[model samples]
Target: MLVLPKESRKLFKGPFGILHRDISTVLPELAGRTVYTVGDVVTHTLQKNGITPSIAVVDGQTMRSPCSRMPEFSGECIRVENPAGTITDDLVKALTYAINHTPVTIVVNGEEDLAVIPLVIAAPEAAVVLYGQPHKGIVLRTIDAGAKAAAQELLGLFVRVGA
Candidate 1:
């Protein structure tokens, strides 16, 4: 494991464990694992922007409401539709646009069905994903080995990337 300087290591002892150590290696790996969905991307972007996303409501109607009142975030909002049935060029284009755009931190709040938003919105080269419950500090199903690994990797990245 990589070690930190004395002051850095001390700061990492408790809840700060999330922000400890060599994270440059972790961000890119985590970005690869994130699934594509609108809500998930928005939340991930918000977090990256340094705004603690308090919650996400999944219903499409909620997304329709204006985000004017919502606090500022680091990333753009993206929409993701089911790939098999309703996927369209427009949606894909939107995802590409969002991803190609600059990084923005955001807290995602949306319906469960749209959880993959983060993956689609992130730049192909950028290693970031939305796969956790910020409030509970949990992400991707823990029992699923791949999912867990992806989440851990993303968490490591987020700690350093949030700046």
Candidate 2:
């Protein structure tokens, strides 16, 4: 597992990609492509808008609170335990598997916020990762060399931990 140190908290404060209040404009362009969503609100929104993402990472909560509406996915469900502000090996494995197996929902027991970091690093070119930015809006990250590099930079902020 890797822990996000206190100093790194501020590093993850802002959206890492383009922010959109309305995700509809981006949805139509993503048809027949590998799209990923990382948050309950965004995942639920995609499902509601009839755009089923290829792989979605959700923690069953929004804004750090138990969400009243949980995203319902018909495909395979992958469960992993990753505490808040930390990323575990289990989470990485699940994400790697989900990327290949389309239409999967990865339900994180603790939190799914940091999952996007590894995901951006693992995502293939041309694939888009959309996540919610709390009250701000949705963030759309188009996976590519730059996105991977940015994610790697953030990954470096984490301190590796042992069992």
Candidate 3:
């Protein structure tokens, strides 16, 4: 749905939502909430900490390197091809399905970094979405009017190139 333009790369360098240095702190806030995770490390960390998010989006890579420990979820695994700087239609379909069907893991063939944008836009209100913040930590974004607007703004910054 959104494609990153070369000139706008700098805008996405940091986290789009609340940055939590410790994922544990965010875990307590996540109790009894629908959570969707994006990025391998973030998902693995959550699982290791005893929190199984409703959905996880992973690309088998972290920081552009092959992930040593790919997050494993025993649920419906949907695979889609989303290029490094773009969100594919197939991927959006998977995420849409995941919303109704909780406990889904989306395995991206290319990259899952940018998937957070569309996921946030499509996520139901009050849902929580988590993703890594590069060298910092995890970001906790709640799906609400403000968050959705922020995500939509970020996506808008990307050049819309597809029909």
Candidate 4:
């Protein structure tokens, strides 16, 4: 387990790719690339646009509140337990498994916000990881050596707990 510090918010400010107010605007860029959605809103937006992500990670909540029933996704469903403000070994394993399986939905028990870190780290080169920026818009991060390195560096700041 790893606890993220409040100060680490600065590291997450700049996205690895573009931030689009309209998710549809980035559809062309997602073509021919594996898409990994790290939030409920981002996944729902993509589905509404008729685009299914290769992997969707959701905790059935938005802004710490219950979401409108989980959306129906077409793929294998794997559930894992992850607490708020922290990442667990289970999440890392689930992300690794989901990336390998492809087209799977990871239903997290607690929160899925920080899942983007591991998603960026485990995603294949050229893959796109999408997540919502609260009331702002959607952030599209392209998985590359630089992005992976940055994610790893940020994750290193977390305080690791028991395995």
Global lDDT scores for all candidate models: 0.33, 0.90, 0.89, 0.87
lDDT of 4 by residue, 92-156 (tens): 99999999898899999999988999889999999999988878788899988999998898899
Clashing pairs in 4: none
Candidate 4 CA-lDDT value: 0.87
Alpha carbon deviation, residue 147, candidate 2 (Å) = 0.3
CA-only RMSD, every prediction: 15.4, 1.1, 1.3, 1.6
At residue 115, candidate 3 shows an lDDT of: 88
Specify the poorest-scoring 10-residue window by lDDT in model 1.
12-21
105-129 per-residue lDDT for model 1 (tens digits): 2232223322333232333422333
- Give residue 75's lDDT in candidate 1 (0 to 100): 49
User: Which parts of model 2 have CA positions greater than 4 angstroms off?
Assistant: none
Q: TM-score-based ranking, best first? A: 2, 3, 4, 1
**Which candidate number has the best lDDT?**
2
Better of 3 and 4 by lDDT: 3
lDDT of 3 by residue, 9-123 (tens): 8898888889999977898889888889999999999899888889999999999999997888748999998889998889989999998898899999999998888899999
Error of 1 at 68 (Å): 13
Tell me how many clashing residue pairs each candidate has: 27, 0, 0, 0
- My TM-score estimates for the predictions, one after another, are 0.31, 0.95, 0.94, 0.93
Runs of candidate 4 exceeding 4 Å displacement: 13-16
